[model samples]
Target: MAPRPNVVLVVMDTARACETVHERYDYLSELNRLAQTGTEYTKAVASAPWTLPSHASLFTGTYPSKHGAHAGHKHLDEGIPTLAKAFQDGGYETVAVSNNTWISEEFGFARGFDTLYKTWQYVQADIDLGKIARTKQGTEMIHALATRLAEGNPVINAANAIYGQFFRKRTDDGANRTNKWIREWLANRNDDEPFFCFVNYLEPHLEYRPPKSIAERFLPNDVTYGEAMSVPQDAWGYIAGTVDLTDRQLGILRALYRAELAYLDRCLGELRRHLEAAGEFDDTVFVVTGDHGENIGDHGLMDHQYSLHETLLHVPLVVHGPRFETGQVDDLVQLTDLAPTLLDAADIDAPELRDASQGRSFHPEAEIPPREHAIAEYMAPQPSMDALRERVGTSTDNIERFDRSLRAIRTDDEKLIRGSDGTQEFYELRNDPEEATNLATERSERVDTLETMLDEWLDTFERADTSGEVSMTDATEARLEDLGYLQ
Candidate 1:
C-alpha cells in the first residue's frame, strides 16, 4: 500500500461561503484555484454559528449537543475523541497552529497535538493593542499619544492621525505568522512520518481591518474604518432597532469584510507556495474551510451568534488531495462531516461516541447517501446575555429575544429557523436565497415536515451534561471582548 498522505486542515475563521468562493465576491483566489484541482462542497453547513461549538463539531464528527463545547460549557468534553487524537493514535504527527483562543490548550483543543503553536503567544502585543482599541477611553488615549508624537512634521502628523483613528497596527499577520510557524516546523520534522496539521485563521472575524492596499481595492472612495467603528459595537442594539445605519454605511462594512477576505487569500497563497517549495504539496491532503460564517448586515445582525441564517451557517469547504476527485458537489454537507471525511482520507477509523458520527465522508468515491438536510444550533446562557446587555445598555428583554437557544434545519431548497421563544421562520431557498421571506405561516405542510426531520435529528444525539462550569482567565475574557464575542 502507498504511504498515508499528510493531512492539513485550514479553518478560516468567520469566512462566509458566499463571499469567499461564491461568485458574489470571489475574494479567495488561491482557495478557488485549489477548488479547481479538488472537490468543493458548495453547500457546506456548520453545526453552530459561533466558534467554540462549531469547532468542536468539526473536530468531533458530531453535533454541538454531543460534544457540548458551547456558550454554557466553554470546553470540549475530554471523553469525546477529536480528529487530531485519531490521527495521533494512528501514529501521525499532530500539530495545530491556532489564532482563536477558544482553540487553545486550556479548552481541550490541544488533546492530541505534538506541537501546538498558538498565535496569541507570538502576538500578545497585537492582542493587547486590539483590546485597547475597542474601548472609547483607550482610543482617546492612543489618539492623544499619536498627536504628541506627530508635533514635528505636518505630513507625519496627518499620517499619525490616520493611523491612530483608522488603521490598527497589526503586529501579528495572523495566517502569515501561522504559515511561517508551519514552514519552520515542516523543516524540522522527519519526512518518514505523516502529519496532521490544523490551522485556524482569524482574518475575517470582527473589527475588520484589512491592509490599506487591499481595502482600497474593494471599498468606495469615502469608506473609512474610523467611520465603520463609529457604529455601535453591540449587534443587539441594531437587531432591536435601537441602532440604525444607512445603506451606504452597511455597504462600506461589507466592503471592509471582503477586503479582509482578500487579504487572507494572499496569506493562503503564501502558505501554498511554501508547501510546494517543500515538495510536499502533491503528497498532502488539504481541507480548507470556515468554522462558521459571519453576518455582515444580514437579519439586522452585525456578527455571528444571534441567528442561524445562511450567512452564518453556510461555509465554504474545499478538499484537495491525492485521494479526492476534482469536482463540485451540490449535496448539502455539514462541518461535522469534515472530521469523518478527513479521517477517511487518512484511512483512520473514527472513534465511537454516545451517538454514532452524524458526519459522512464527502469524498467522491465514498458510497454514502446524499444528506437530506443540515442542522445548526445556538445556545447562550442568561449570564452572558445579561453581561452583553449591561455593556451595551440594551434592554434585557430585547437582547434575550435574539439570544435565545434555537435550532435551524436547511435542505437544498428550503430552510426553517425556530427560536426557543416560539418564533419561527421558514424560507424556500430556491426563490428566497436571501431568506427575506418567512414562509412558516404560509406553508404549514412544509414546516411540519421539516420540523419533524429536525426533531428526529435532534433525537439521535444525547445532550451533554454542562453542570461543570468552565471558567476563562481575565486575559482570555478581554480577548473575546475585543473580538465582540464577550460583549
Candidate 2:
C-alpha cells in the first residue's frame, strides 16, 4: 500500500481576507499560485476574533465556548482532544514551530506534538546568554564581571536593557528560523513515518515592520520607513478614545501591513520549494489559512477586539493535497471543520474529537450536510478594560462601551450581531460589504429571524470545564506586551 500523505498546517497570524486574497494584492503571487493547485475557500470564517480562542477552535473541532479559551479564561481545557494528539496516536510524527507566545507549551498548545519549538526563544539574546551564564561558579564569575562593567551608569544600563529586549530580537517574527528548523528536521529524520508539521508566521500581526528590502517595494509613494516605524502600536489607547491617530499615521500602518503580507507570501513560496526539494511535496497535504484578521482602521478600531464584523471574521483558507480537489469553493465554512477533514484524510477515527466537535467535514467525498449559517463569538474585552486604563494612564468614557460580550451569525446575504448589553446590529452583506450601515431598526422582521437562528445555536453550547490559571515567565509577558496584548 502507498504510504499515507504528510500533513502541514501553516497559519498566517492576523491576516485579513480583504487584503491577502488573490483579487486584492498583486504581491501575493506565491500564495495565488498555490491556490491554483488547491481549493480556496473565499468565505471561510473564524470562530473568534482574536488568537487564543480562535486557535483553540482550530486545534479542537469546537467553538470557543466549548473549548473554553477566551478573554474570561486563558487556558484550553486539558480534557479536550487536539488534532496533533490524534495524528500522533495514528502513528504520524508530529512537530510544531510557533512564534506566538500564546501558542507555546505553557498554554497546553504543545500537548500533542513530539517536539514543539518556541522560535521566540531562539531570537532572544538573553536566552543565548543564559547558556554561557549557567549556574556553575565559572559561568557565574563571567556573568558577574560583565554585569560590573556597566553597573554604575544609568544610561549604559538602560541601553543594555533596550538592546537585550528589542534590538537583539528578530523583526521578521521568526519565519526564517522556523523554515530553517523544519528543513533541518526533514533532512535528519530516518524513520519513514508520515509527519504532521504545524507552522505559524506572525510577521503581519502587529508592529508591522517588514524587512527593508521587501518593504520598499510595497510602500506608497508618500509613506516613508521612518513614518511607518513611528506609528503607535497602542491599539488600546486608540480604542479607548484616549489617543487619536492622524490620517498620515493610518496610511503608514496600512502600507507596512501590506509589506508584511507580501513578505509572508515570499516565505510561503520558500517553504513549498523546501518541501519539493526534500522529495515530500507531492505527498504532502498543505493547509494555508489564518487564525483571525486584524482591524486596521476598520470600524474605528486599530486591533482585532470588541467587534465581530466581516473585517475580523472573514479569512482565507486554501487546501492542497492528493485528497483535495483543485478549485474555488464559495461555500460558507468554519475553521473548526479543518480538524475533521484532516483526520478523514489520514483515516484516523477518534470518537472524542467527533463527539466534541460542532463542525462537519468539507471533504469532497464526504456526504456532509450543507451549512445554513456561520457563527462567531467574542467574549468580553481582552486585555481587559483595567489593563487598557493602566496602559493609557487614565480612564475614558468609551471603556464601558466595550465591556459587553458579542455573538454574530451570518447567512449568504445578511448578518446580525447581538451584544450582551442588548445592542443589535444588522447588515446586508451584498450591498454593504464594508458593514457601514445598520438595518437593525429599519428591518425588524429580518433581524428577528436572524436573532432566532443565533439563539438556537447558542443553546447548543456546552461550556467546557475550564478552571485554571496561567503562569508565564517575565520574558513571555514582555513579549506579549510588545505584541500589544498586555500593558
Candidate 3:
C-alpha cells in the first residue's frame, strides 16, 4: 500500500484572488506556476470578511454561525473538531506556524497541534536570539518571558527593555521566519509518521512595508519610497470618513499592497525550493489559499471590515498532489470544503466530520456537484462602534452605517447583501464587478429569491456552544493593535 501523503496548508493572510489569481502580478509567477500544476478554483470564496471567522470556518468545516467564532465571539468553541485534530487522531504529526495573532493559542487555534510557533516571538535578524528560540520549547519559553515582561514583571526589566527593541523592529511579519522554521522542521521531523502542517504568511496583510527593491517596481516612477511610507495605513479613518485619501495616496497604497504580495510570492518560491531539496515535494500534498483580502482604497475603504463585497470574499485556492487532477476549476468552492477534501486525501473515514460540515468535498475523481450559490457572513461589527470611536478619537454618521451585521449570498452572475438593519444591496456581478451600483429596488424579484436562499441556508445550523471567553497576553494584544485588528 502507498504511504499516506503528508499535507501542508499555506494561508496567505489578506491575499485576494483578484490581485493574485484573477489579475496576477508578473512577480507572482511562483503562485501562478503552482496553480498550473494543480487544481485552482477561480471562484473560491472565504466564509467571512476577516481572519478570525474565516480561519475558524477553514479549521472546522462550518460557517461562522455554526462555529461560533466571529466578531461577536472571539473564541472557537471547544465542541467543534478542527482539521488538525482529525489528522492528529489519524496518527499524523500535526504542526502549525502562525504569524497572525488571531490564530494564536489564546483563540483556541492550538488545539490539535503537537507544535505551534508564534513567529513574532523570535528575533528576525539577530543571530544570538534566534539560536536561543530556535527549538519549539525554546520558542515557548521565550514567549512566556516576553509575556511576563509585558505584564509588568519587574525582575526582568533590564532584559525586557533590551528585547523590546528587537521585537518592535520586526518588519517582515514572519515570512522569513516561517520559511526558516519549516525548513528546519522538514530536516528534523520524523520520517515514519505522515505530517500535517498549517502555515500562515502575514506579509500581505496591512502596514504594507515591502522591501525597497520590490516596492520600486509597483510604485510610480516619481513616487519615492519615503513618500509611499508617509501615507497613513489607517483603515478606520477611511471608513469613518475622517481621513480622505487623495488619488495619488490611493495609488501609492495599491502599489504597496501589490508589492507586499510580490515579496510574499518570492518567499513562497523559496519555500517550494526548500521542500524540493528535502526530497518530499512530490509526495506531499500542498494546499495554498488566503483567509481574506484587503480593500486598499477599494469602495473608499482601507481595510477588509464593514463589507462582504467580492474584494473581501473572493480568495485564491489551489490544491496540488499526485492524487489530485491538474488544471483550473471554475466551481464556486468555499474555504470550508478544504477540511473534508484533505481528510479524504488521507483516506480517513470521518463520518462525524462529514456530518458536521456544511461543505462537500470536491475531490478530483468525484463529479463536480452543482452548487447553487456561495454564502458569506459578517456576524458582528469588528472593533465595535465604541472601540472605533475611541480609536479614531471621534465618530461619524457614516460610522453608524457599518454597525450592523451583514450576510451575503451570491450566484454565478448576481449577489445580494442583506444587512442586520433590514437594508439590502443587490449587484449584477457580471457587468459591475466592482459592485458600484445597488440594484435592490430595481431588481426586487431577484433580490427576494437570493435573500430567501440565504435565510434558508442559515436556518440549517444553530450556533455552537461558546461558553468561555478568550483572553490574550498584553504582548498579543499589542500585536493585534499593530496589525490594525484592534484599537
Candidate 4:
C-alpha cells in the first residue's frame, strides 16, 4: 500500500473562521491563495474555551472530561494517546511546535512527539511597540510621553500606543516562530517515514497588539483613533472586574486584532513558499483552524474566559488535502473530531478503545450528519473561600466542594448555558450571534429540549480525573504569564 501523506495541523489561538482569509478577511491575499488549494470549514466549534483542554481533545479525539486536563496552564497526563503518538505507532515521526506557554515540555504536552518546542518567550520589554506608538515623532513623542508621566498627566496616550503595538508585534512573532519551526523540522525528514506535526500560533489571542505596518493596513480611513484606543474591553458580567473600554479603545483593539490576522496570513505565505518549493504543499494533508475564538464586544464580552456564546464557541476549521473535498462542511464539528479526522487522513485506524470516543472521523466525500448542538465547558473563576462557603451554604471546611463551574450546549440557532446552582443562559444564536438574549426562562419549551440534550451529553461525559483543582508550579506560571495568561 502507498504510504499515507504527512499531516500538518496548524491551530491559531483565538482565530475565528469569520476573520480568516477564506471567510471574513477580504484583504487576505495569502489566505485566499491557501484556500484555493484547501477546504475551509465555515463553522467549526471548539471543545473548550482555553488552551489545555481544547488541545487535549484535539490531540486525543476525546473530550476534556475524558482526558482530565480541564483547566488552563495544567499538564495533560502522559497516559493519553496523543495524535503524534498514534502516528509514531504507525511508523511516522511526530512533531509539535507550540507558542502556548502552558503547553510545554514542562507540562505533559511534549509527550509522544519526537520534536516538541516552545516559541520565544514574550516579555514586558516587547511592549516597546506601544512605546513607539506614543512617540509620534520619535524624540518629541518620547519627550511628550515622559513629560506626561512625570507630570502625572496619565500618559494614557503612551500606554495606548504601547498596547496597540504590543499585541500586533506579539502575534506577528508567533507566526514567524511557526514558520521557523516547520521549516527546520522538515529539513531533517526521514524520507521513508510519514509525520504528524502541530504548529500552534498565539495570534489573535489577547493583550491585543498588532504590528504597525499591519495595523494601518486594516484601519478605517474615516476614524481618528486616540491614545485611549489601546486595551480591548474588559469582559462583561463581572462588570467591576473588567476594564471599561471607550469607543477609541475598541477601534484600536480591533486594529490590533486585524493586524494579527494579517501577520498569520503573512507567515502562512512564507510557509506555503517553503512547502511548495520542497514539493510537499500538495502532497501534505494540512488543517488550518483555531481552538476557540475571542469575544470582542460580542455579547458584551471582551475576550474569552467567560460565556460560551458564539463569539467563543464558533471557531474556524478548514481541511485540505489529497482525499478531502474542497467544499465546506456545515456539520457541527468539534475539536475532538480532529483526532479521528487526522487519523483517518493518515489511513490509521483509531485504537479499538477509542470506539467509546465521542467524536467520529470525516471521510473526504461522506455526508456529515446534523448535530443537535456543540458543547462548551468552563471552570469559571472561583470565588474567594469565604464566598464559596457562603454559596455552598455549608461549612467553610469543605471549600473544595464549590468550584464555580459552567457549561453550554450551542445549536445553530440557539444556546443553553448552565452555571453552578442551576443558573442558566439561553440565546437564539440565529437572531443574536452576540448572545445578547437569555431565553432560559422566557423560552421554556426550547430550553427543555436543550436541557435534556445537555443532560444526555453529560451522562456520556467521561470526566477526566483533574480533581477540579489546578495550581501550576511557579516556573510554569512564569511561562503562562509570558504567553499572556492571567497569573
Candidate that scores best on lDDT: 3
Order of the predicted models by lDDT, top scorer first: 3, 2, 1, 4
lDDT preference between candidates 2 and 4, better one: 2
| Residue 32 CA displacement from its true place in model 3, Å | 0.7
Indicate whether candidate 1 or candidate 2 has the larger TM-score.
Answer: 2
Per-residue error at 282 for model 4, in Å? 1.4
Per-prediction TM-score to the true structure, in the order listed: 0.88, 0.91, 0.92, 0.81
User: In candidate 3, what are the lDDT values of residues 241-338, reduced to their tens digit?
Assistant: 77888999999999999999999999989988988998888888998999998798888787899999999999988888877777888878999889
Please report, in order, the local distance difference test score of every candidate based on alpha carbons. 0.78, 0.82, 0.83, 0.67
Which 10 consecutive residues of model 1 have the lowest summed lDDT?
A: 122-131
lDDT of 3 at 227: 98
Clashes, model 2: 0
lDDT tens string, model 1, 156-177? 4444334433443463336767
Candidate 1 TM-score over all chains jointly: 0.88
**Which portions of model 1 show Cα errors greater than 4 Å?**
23-26, 123-173, 222-237, 240-242, 351-356, 381-383
Better of 2 and 4 by TM-score: 2
What does the lDDT come to for candidate 3? 0.83
Clashing pairs in 3: none
